[model samples]
Target: MSRIVVIGGTGYAGSHIAREAVSRGHEVTVISRQAPDAPLDGAQYVQGSVLDLDALGDVFDGADAVVSALSPRGDMENEVIGALRGLIKRLAGTPSRLGVVGGAGGSLVAPGGPRLFDQGFPEEYKHEAQVGIDSLELLQQTDDLEWFFIHPAEVFGPWVEGERTGRYRDGGDVLVRDADGNSTISGADFAIAVVDEIEQPKHRNDRFAVGY
Candidate 1:
């Protein structure tokens, strides 16, 4: 089983992913500003801040893969991409694979042009949402790094907990939409997709979007 490190594992999306990874028998370690309210069965929770470079590296030690589910929020919140800059540097020369969670707005809607956020996305989400977009850009420019970026469709969060039918559509660059022209997915299904990538690596050094 892989020893996976999940940053921001206490967040809504991160928690779901941590749960799925543990259910699959992987040794999962969750690093968050605070431990999850109820830790997953097979996972270890570490209460820490991602902005602490040395402490973050300790979490990555001996890790087979690293998944970043970090998002910026509130007044004192650390900048998502900024914090990752240090973490990525610390992971250099390691055999670990990296996967980062991105937002729908960050997913490309066109080639070398507009992102999903540019297409009339709400201003309220621009701050935290743009962090994901910038993080994806940062990952793309770092050609030397081994990383995978996963973007969830328009529908994401605790409310959309659908069953794990083990089926979903994958898209490159653009967001995937359903018949109703709405691209969305339950967080549970999103977690399934994340763990699936852990077990079977795909879209390395590239970004992928998933939806119903």
Candidate 2:
């Protein structure tokens, strides 16, 4: 079993990914500022902030892979990008592969077209979307850091509460949509895609999307 560390593992997406990893028999550790409301089974939870490089380094040590499922919110909005940079710095020369949970805002609606953020994305979510975009851009510029950014569809979140079908469509920078022109996926299925990528290592040093 591979040793896996999931930053912000108690949050919605992070928690689901942690559970999926544990179910797969991988040794999983979750690091976050706050603990989950209900503890996850078969996964170890470490309460701490990602900003603490010393603590973050300790948890990341000797891990096979690290999944960053952190979202940009509140105080985290301005800090997520910096935290990611710090993570990359710490992971330099390490064997761990970094996996990031990205937002659709940075994804493309069409090939060679404007990013979703420039295509009339909601104003309230603009900041978070840009943060995701910036994070992807930063990763793209990093040299020799094994990484993959997983972007979800436009309609994905805890509020959506999509059903877990154990299935999803994978796409490149373009957004994936159903025949009816809808884009969505449950948190559970998204986690499935993530864990699959973690185990198989497809789309290395690139970005991809998953949706129903």
Using Cα atoms with residue i matched to residue i, what is each candidate's TM-score against the true structure? 0.93, 0.97
lDDT of 1 by residue, 1-212 (tens): 99999988988889888888998899999998875677788889888887786765467888888899987777424478778887788777788888999888888775675788888989988887888878888887775568999989887877776666767788877788887888778778888999888888888888889998
lDDT of 1: 0.83
| Tens-digit lDDT track of model 2 for 1-212 | 99999998988899899999999999999998986889988888888888887865478889999999888897787899999999999897899999999898888888886788898899999988988989999999988789999999999999998888999999788888899989899999999999999899889899998897
TM-score of 2: 0.97
- Report the number of clashing residue pairs per model: 0, 0
> Candidate 1, TM-score vs. the true structure?
0.93
RMSD of each: 1.8, 1.0
Model 1: ten consecutive residues of lowest lDDT: 71-80
